[model samples]
Target: MQALKGIAASNGIAIGKLKLCVKLDDKIAKKPITDVEAEIKRVESAKEEAEAALNRIYLDALKRVGEENSMIFQIHIMMLQDDDFFDAIKDCISDEKVNAEYAVWQAAQQFSTMFAQMDDEYMRARSADVVDISKRLLSCLDPNLDSGLDSLKEEAIVAASDLMPSETVQMDKSKVLAFVTEQGSKSSHSAILARTMSIPAVVGLCDAFSSLKDGAMTIVDGSAGDVIIEPDEATLKEYEQKRDAFLQHQKDLQLLKGTKAVTKSGVEMEINANIGHPSDVEMVLENDADGIGLFRSEFLYMESDDFPTEEQQFEAYKTVLEGMKGKRVIIRTLDLGADKQVPYLNIPKEENPAMGYRAIRISLDRKELFVTQLRALVRASAFGKLAIMFPMITSVEQVKEIKELLNQVKADLKAEGVAFAPDFEIGIMIETPASVILSDLLAKEVDFFSVGTNDLTQYTLAVDRMNPQISSMYDPRHPAVLRMIQMAAENAKKAGIWIGICGESAGDTELTRFYVDIGINELSVTPGTVLELRRTVQQLD
Candidate 1:
């Protein structure tokens, strides 16, 4: 048996034949064009057809995936109509005097390469979007090409270099048992689509993926990121058993929805969801999460061209709060700076951005920005249970300062005859070492402690988790990081305050028992993983 490891893109297991998929061919021979206007007209016609195709795809994706995930297709439609992209194609056709196909291909390459080189991960993933739409346009120009998933007649594990959003959506999903890609990340549209589609997937297999052959028996343990090819008799039987058990395990876990996350010993832990936008509240409720643990407010800022107005922020907070139906919602105040830079904010470049002016630093420096968000949260709190948390907190002074600001917001609201929830909780994220060290003191001031382990691990280990070169060194399970978390948990307990982990680490089912043992009050993860975490807790003592 030969095995390959990759990033676990989606959860589940599959055992089937390997069916290799071919990517859409973007290579077109350049032909000198005599009629520039005619070629431009052709490009314009193809562009409209592409947009119409995307609109249809958007509706199809909306049915398969939710509105939030389906928005990517709508984004592609917008990209097709983008002035710069359209103008680039027209300019290429006019300057290079190339065929419309060649001009579209050239413009796509230029933009895709530029996006791929960007510092932001989200923008980097957009390179695929450019290529996807270009291929759609190419197909519209010529009727012969397709994304290549239409040939599958049998259920098999689909292997590809990297599946694009359009290709993944257009594929006959019923025939695909699992997906194995040579290049992709969790943030990629393909991976996100897999999760929403509930298909087993393993991506970024790189060189190991070359060994895969058509019609070969394969076992894909997506939950473990393992792909086994041509397994021997014993190994095949072992995996067959494992696959059966996993399928049964999934069915078993579904029964856990709406049930509390309680261990065998009857210790309960709140299993909440981390959401970037209000639209995600549907999935949180679908998974029956205890509440909303981390509502990343920065997405509201990141999505807007300018700062989101107080009423805009209020509506968003209100939508989520109302959606949760009185369930506890913890909103992390604007964590702008570093990787999540807003162009309008005009934050200066930093040598090491992760540790530099970010999170609470930005909030404190620009008090008005912070005040705007707090004012929105305060006004929305009256709709449902809400808890506001400050990120990148290092000292008691920051928490004290935050409370003073909160008090002023309350006073202002009162004088203006605005009713707000006074019983809402205030908390600080135990991410920095300073916060962990001073958790004993910080706990007394705050109502609770929510550990942002993603940052805590990086900060404690002095490793940039985003740097692929050193990502291996940034272990959240490292002893030092665990020690810091344990210290904070102990301190919170000592101070008689509840504590929880609202980070990527919380989604790790392997650590479910560890968290329960350490007296963690809650585990906030992706909405889809809530039941799995509940299962882990129930199985543990």
Candidate 2:
């Protein structure tokens, strides 16, 4: 028996045969080109074909997953059409006079190298996008290349060096029981998609288990981040028992659905879901979520070719609001820039984007974009209980600016005779250390505060949580982070405004009791954790 350790990305277990999916070897030989114009034409034609393929993938992904998840394909399409990307390829073809395939490959390598050398892990991960687009263009130029993941005869544990978003989206999901990657992290696209699909996944194996033969019997313990190849009889039996117990535990957690999230001492707290798109409402209702505490509204903007119109944004908000059936839904306005980039926004490149032009800062500066979203949210508010929250807020001035624009939007809507809820609530996300310290002053201006502990912890600890190298230091349970949360919670209490945690820390069961003890009014987590969080609340004294 051979055992390999990896990062536990998704929580589950699968016992199945191994299917080694080696990426297609698309190495192209450079050849002197007689006609540089012909090479440029060929590259352009291949780009057009790649665009068509990506559009098809985007549509398919939209139908399968919601627009939020489907935006990855759209972003891929944008990368293909990017002026810089196209210029690089054209420059290679014109200046180097190389074959179209080699030129594309060289251009891709240049951009990939740039991203890989970045200090930020998220930006570094973008190298995969450049590689994926290059591979697609290469495949378009040479049709013989095979990805090997498109065809699967039976359910098996897929092993690969790594998976790009396009490749993961195109694979036969039913045949893929689990995934083991030699290179990846929890924030990788494959990991994110695996969690969304509720499939077992273990990444960052780093070539340790790459020698395992194809079709070998394997046990993937995703919860423990262990991949066992050709396990002995005794070991297999032990895993079988453990898998059964885990499955049974999942079944038992379902009974907690529809139950109140009240503590044993009669302290009732709201248990909400953090959703990315409208389709997530189904999972929220299935898990009996109190409401959506964070409806990420950036997907609409990201998926579209241009800015999302007010009606488009309104329909999305309306869908979630109507589906929740009067339950409170907090829609955060366009948290763009930073890690999440929209090319058309023309946000200048920054050395450190996380602390740069992003979230509320962008909205405050781009009043028209901010107003468009506000108008839609206000219009949708009339359908059900809807509240708007601003992200990355660090000062009273930002909050004041947002309120002024919101008032303008409300006045414009009222003058136009548009029906909207006049009393809709406004809140600010307490993410930065400054926000935590100034919580008292900010609380007086907003209806409530939702501590975005993900950023709060990162900024407070001076650690980038996505950077695997220093990820160990990015602990939410750190004394400084806890103190900030406590300070925010206490300030909200004094101001008579509710405060909730809508970050990954909210789902940490080990900290549930501490959150309760600190008087956190709400805990907004992913839908899968809603019942578990409710169970934790129930057991809290």
Candidate 3:
């Protein structure tokens, strides 16, 4: 038996026959076009067809995976119409005098190459999106050509060089027992879809693809990122037992749904989910989270082409609030800047972005942008339980300034005859060391404290978490970092305000008891981890 290792993208185990995904060869020779206008028209028509196809796919994915995960298709549709991208195709057709298909391919290559060279991991992963959209355009230009993923005849493990987001979303779900890809990271859209669909997936198995024979019996342990091809009898039997145990564990976790996260001693803990978009509420509801701890308001801006208007932000917030029914949803206001940059905002790039103009700094500096968001949040408050949280706050003065802005927003709304919940709570994230040092004073200024350990650890430890050279030094469990969190918890209690953790460290089961002992009232984590955290909390003393 040949065993291969890759990055685990989802949790599950599957043993099935392997089926190689079939993809159409898109390589085409560039040919001279006699009529440039006709070529442009052909390209435009192909784009229209591609957009329509994507819209249909979007609806299908929306129904199956909810809106958040399915937003990839909507993004694909947007990318098709982007001025820079579409203009490149048109320029290639007119300037290079090439066929529509050739122009599309050329444009795809150029943009994909540019994106591949990007410093940001998210933008780099988008290189695949450029290829996916171009393939769709090619299919539109040539009716005979097609993007695969619809050819599955039976249940099997789907292996491919790489599955695009569209192909993964459109694949026959019942026939796909698991996914094995030769190239893709855990953050890839295909991997995200696999997680959303609860399909076992192992990606970035480049060397193993050479030995992956079609119809060969294979065992995929996604949780362990292991794939064994043509396993021996003993190994197969062992894996069968392992798979059974994992399935049982998952079934047992499902039983924890709708149950409170309470210890044997009857200490109730709140298990909430951190979400970036409205559609993620579906997963939150499915996981039976107590509430949304960190509603990242920046994604609504990042996902858009330009500044999202007040009404647009309001609708998005209102959607999440109403969906949660009366459960508290803490929305962090506009944490933009640093790694999360908006090109239109045109904030000058800095040498040190993490400790630079980001989060509350940008909000306070750009009062117009901050006011617009606060107005939207105030309006959304009428829909359900809403709490506003500020990030990267280092002083009481910043909190006072935020309150001033919020008070002005309320006054405007009240005078305009608009309905808003006046009882909405205010909170601040304890991310910076300065904030943790002043936690007692900061806590008194807000209704609650949510320790953002991801940043708190980075700042306190003097390590840039994104810098690979010293990422090993960035440990949230560092005694110093934990001490800071404990200090914040103590100060929150002293100020009569509740405290919680809303960071990557919140899901660390090893630290759950430590947090409980430090008087942490809540733990907010990714939606998939809610049940696991609940199980951990229930087992605690």
Candidate 4:
């Protein structure tokens, strides 16, 4: 038996023979494409195969993960059918004089390079489609090349040197069990797809996975970050007992669903989810949350050439409100900067992007973009409960500017005879130290406050989030972070404004009593966390 510790990406357990997914390194092909028309025909055939594979996964996934979510394959479909993609192939086949398969694959390689350099996460995911298309093209061009998918016939744990999102789409449903990837992380598309499929997964185990030969007896406990290869009798028995206990625990968690978030004394505490997309409405509804507390609206802006218009914003917000059936949905205006630079805005390169122009700073500078989102939020308000919050508010001046813009938006709507909620609550995320320390005065002006502990801790500690050297210092449990959160809550309590916690600390059960003790009423977290939070709140006296 061998043990290796790594960042636990997903939580689950599995015991099956390991199935390794080898990532072929990008290298020059032996038999390259040499004809132009032949390359086009070859590309067409590869795409057809990819489309069929995608359809197969979509059909199988619809049985378990619903049609709405299993549609990640469509992203690949769009890539395969892209027009510019075919043009690039023509250029490559005509100029490069390579074999038809190699020509299309070469063109895809260029596209892959372009995607890999992009800063956005969703765009980065498209790199997988490029690789998938290329590999599929190469396989079709030469009938002799091996895809190594024959391993799926046996019941084994799926292992990959690196699995892209599209590659995992048509994964073996019954024969393949869990996933172990040398590349990617929890947030990576490969791991996310594995988790959604209810398959146990472990990533960042560079060379540890391959040490176990194919068909070797293995036990992968993703929850505890364990991988046992050739386990002894005692080890096998221990895991068997553990696996049985985990099954029962899952059953217990299922019972917690739909139960109102109440304390031991029946104190009805507000616990809501922080969603990123309109699709997350289903998650909140499924979790039976009190309402939507924080909707990180940055997602809409990231994948666009220009800012989202009022109509598009209104439609997205309307979907969420209708889905929640009149439940409260708080949407934060585009909170982006270095980590989330808007391609349209052209943010300058910064040594530390985390501290650079981000959140409210960018929105305030681009007032038109800010107003558009506000107008949408106001219009969405007529459909159901709605509240708007600003992010990265460091000074009272910033809040005043936002207030003025909100007023201007409301005035314009009224002037145009557009029906919208006349009066709406305006709040700011207390992310910076300046906001937290001066929460008392700021609380009087804003309707409410939400402490964003992730940034709060980073700024207080003066550590850049992306800098690996100082990553070990990012402890939300640090006394400084606790003090700021407590201070913000206390100040908000004194001023009689509703205070919330939307940061990762809000979901921490160990700090639940402490947060409640400090006078925080609303807790906003990921939807998957609501049940455990409800249990914790139930235990709170």
Candidate 5:
């Protein structure tokens, strides 16, 4: 057994023969392209293959997980079909006169590379998207090639250069457990998916691709972020026992499916769903979620053309709130900008779209944009319990400004005598390091704080996710990030404000105990993880 250490992208444990899944990116990069037509053909072929593979993935997910679960593919589907992407590839082929494969890939690399080089790390990390597209092309061109994952019959560790959201989602969530990425990060979508799938995975293993050969005995610890190769008997036995214990614990915890999430000390911790659409509310109910902790209303903006009117917003909020009944709901207002290009919102093109107008900042700049949402939330609150929260807040003054606007919106609503929730709590997301450092000050002014760990970790570490070069450095367990979360939680506590986590870290089962230890008041997670998360928290006290 050969052992190689790299960054752990996803957290999960798997013991299986190494089913080497080499990324064909290097191969695509090496392929020679002589003309623009060849490049176009290659690009089109990749798109077609991506479509077919993605469709298979969707079908596979639906076949295994269910249709609703498969809807996650919508964006991936759109990416393959998006005219912007095609146009980019076309321009590359036409201008560069390269083979179709190289044209699409070269264009994608250039496009993502520009964003990846931005001063804002969060925006820069977006270059993985280009790699994602390139992977689709590679996967498409090599139609007859084996998935590599399919050949593994016995329990074995899986190896890949890195994983994509679509590829990971299509992965057999059960049989081949755990992740070992030669390249990637803990913040990658692969990591997020591993957590969601409850599979232990480790990423950023630098030599995982070049070192580990097929059929190697691999051992990994999802919790400690440890992996051992050619483990001696003791190591193998220890992991086996640990794996079994975890499996049993999982069975026992599911019994808490409908039970209230209380610590052993009997403190109630709100276990809610972090959802994107009103339609997902039923999923919350089905999964027995306590309520909506992070209701991302951004989906409404993403799906609509024009700014969603107060009525449109009200109807959507009503559906979500109505579904949750009297349960508490914390709704995050529209978060859109260059990254989330909605046809309706005519947002200007920016070189660094991620750092450009986005999240609450955008809404605040365009008061009408935010006011419309505020009115809808107020109106919907009248019918159900609601807590409103802002996203991407980086300044204390922004909090105060929102308070003033809330007052004005309230006064306007009262003057109009519109039936609205008489009272609503206001909160802001702590996503930037600036906000994290000043969380105590901001906490005093807001009703609650939801740490957007996704952005927090990205901005804090300065790791551009799209550029796989430095992506290895981005880790949630990095002492610096842990300290930040600890400090923010402490400040929020000092300020006497309830604190919740809504980013990728919130729903993490392994991290639940860590959050509980650090004084997290609530955890807003995906609906599917609610039951397991409740169980994880139940163990804390």
Candidate 6:
């Protein structure tokens, strides 16, 4: 038996034979073009074929994963039609007199290299998108290339170098039990899709391809980040029992769906979802979420090539608000900077971005961007129950400034004859220690407080959660973090405003009782954990 450790991208256990995904080697040697005009025509034909393929993928993803995720393929289609991308390939073929394949490769590399050099992690990761679309175009350029998921004859665990969002969306869920990738992170699109589909996934297995053989019996313990190849009889039996128990546990949790999240002592608690995009509302509804607690509004900006228009942002917000059907949806204003970045934003590179210009700082400094988002949220408020929340706030003055700006936005909207909710609530995320210290003062201004424990812990413990060297020091359950949450909850109560936790800790069953005891009104988490959390609340006195 050979055991390998990797990052657990999803939670589940799968016992199956391994199927190595062999990608088509589309690497074309640089060659002089016999006919420049013919090569250009071939590139155009390939572009058309790629667009058609992406459109089909978009429709399929829309049916399976909803519009938010389907937007990935649509973005690819847009990228293919982009003048810069299209012109780059044409220019390379015409200027360099290279073959169509070589020109496409060069264009992809140039763009991908630019993105890879970016300081922001999210923007740097976009290099993968350029590579993915380029691969699609190359596959179309070669008619004999078979670069698609083959039908599996038996249940198997798929092992690949990495999977693009478009590729993963098209995979057959019935035959593929799980995904084991040689390269991926928790925030990768493949990891996100695996969680959405409830598939077991182990990513960042640096030597998975080298260590495991095709058709070998494998046990994928995604929760523990273990990939066992040709497990011994005893280990296999143990894993079989574990897999069954995990599935049974999931089945049991399904019974909690649609059930009220009230404690045994009759204390009603709001169980909400933390969503990143509009399509996540489907999962929220599926898990019977009482409302949406944290709508990370940065996703709309992050996914776009440039700043999203007011109408675009309004439509995105409206979709979520309308989908919830009267359930409260709290939209947090642009929490960009740090790990998330936009090329057009032109945020200066900082040595310590976490503590630097990010979140509320950027929003306040870039008033235009902030007002545009505020305007959209306000306009969307007329569609359903919508609340605005600010992140990384440390002072009452900031709240005062934000309210003043919000007032300006409201007045502008009113003057323009735009319809919006007249009495939408405002809130702030209690993440920094300074925020916790001033919670009493801050609570007096906002209608509610949502503790973002992830950042709160990081800031309180003085540890960067993303830094592997000191990750162990970044514990959310640390006493200092708990005390800060307690402080915020107490201040909220005294101010007559509801307080909630919208962080990873909110979903922790171990902390559920602690939160209940502290008078927290709500706990918002990812959709997958909503039912389990509901069950936890129901069990609590």
The CA lDDT of each predicted structure is 0.84, 0.85, 0.85, 0.73, 0.73, 0.84
* Model 5 alpha-carbon miss at residue 160, Å: 2.0
lDDT of 4 at 126: 60
Candidate 5 accuracy as lDDT: 0.73
lDDT of 2 by residue, 1-541 (tens): 8998999988888999998865544347888988988888888899999999998987776545545566777668878888898899989888988888888888888998998788776677568889898888988888755455667778888888877777777778788889889887776677767776678999999878666678999999888899999999999999999989989988998998778999999999899988877877898898899999999988787767689999999999999999999999999998887767787899898878889999888888888888888899999999999999999988999889888888888899999999998898999999999999999999999999999988999899988765656766778899999999999999999999999999878988889998998889999987888987898899887
Winner of 1 and 5 under TM-score? 1
Q: For candidate 4, give the lDDT of residue 243.
A: 78
Taking every candidate in turn, the Cα RMSD to the unseen true structure, in Å, is 4.7, 2.9, 4.6, 5.9, 5.1, 5.2
Model 4 Cα lDDT, one tens digit per residue, 313-430: 8998888877888778888888777445545677876655677687788778877777888888888888877888888887888888788888888888888988877666788899
Q: Report residue 516 deviation for candidate 1 (angstroms).
A: 2.5
The model with the greater TM-score, 2 or 6, is 2
Among all windows of 10 consecutive residues in model 1, the one with the lowest summed lDDT is 463-472
lDDT of 6 at 117: 79
Cα-based TM-score, every candidate: 0.79, 0.90, 0.79, 0.74, 0.77, 0.75
For candidate 4, the TM-score is 0.74
Query: Which has the greatest TM-score?
Result: 2
Q: How many pairs collide in each candidate, listed in order?
A: 0, 0, 0, 8, 30, 0
lDDT of 1 by residue, 45-77 (tens): 999999888988876765466444566775687
- TM-score quality measure for candidate 1: 0.79
- The TM-score that candidate 6 achieves is 0.75
Q: Local error of candidate 6 at 315, Å? A: 6.6
List, residue by residue over 1-541, the lDDT tens digit for candidate 5: 4455665544445676667775565555434445667567766767877777776775565434333234445446656677877898788768766656566667677767786777665556556666666666755666543355644566667778777666677566556767677766665667766765667887776754576776777777766667677788887888898888877876776677779878787777788887766767777787888888888776666545467788989998888788788999898887776456665566776766666788877888899888988888888988788999988888888888988898898899889988877767788888888888888788889888888886788788876554556765756667787788889889988888888888767766767778878888888877777888787767776
Which is the winner by TM-score between candidate 5 and candidate 6? Answer: 5
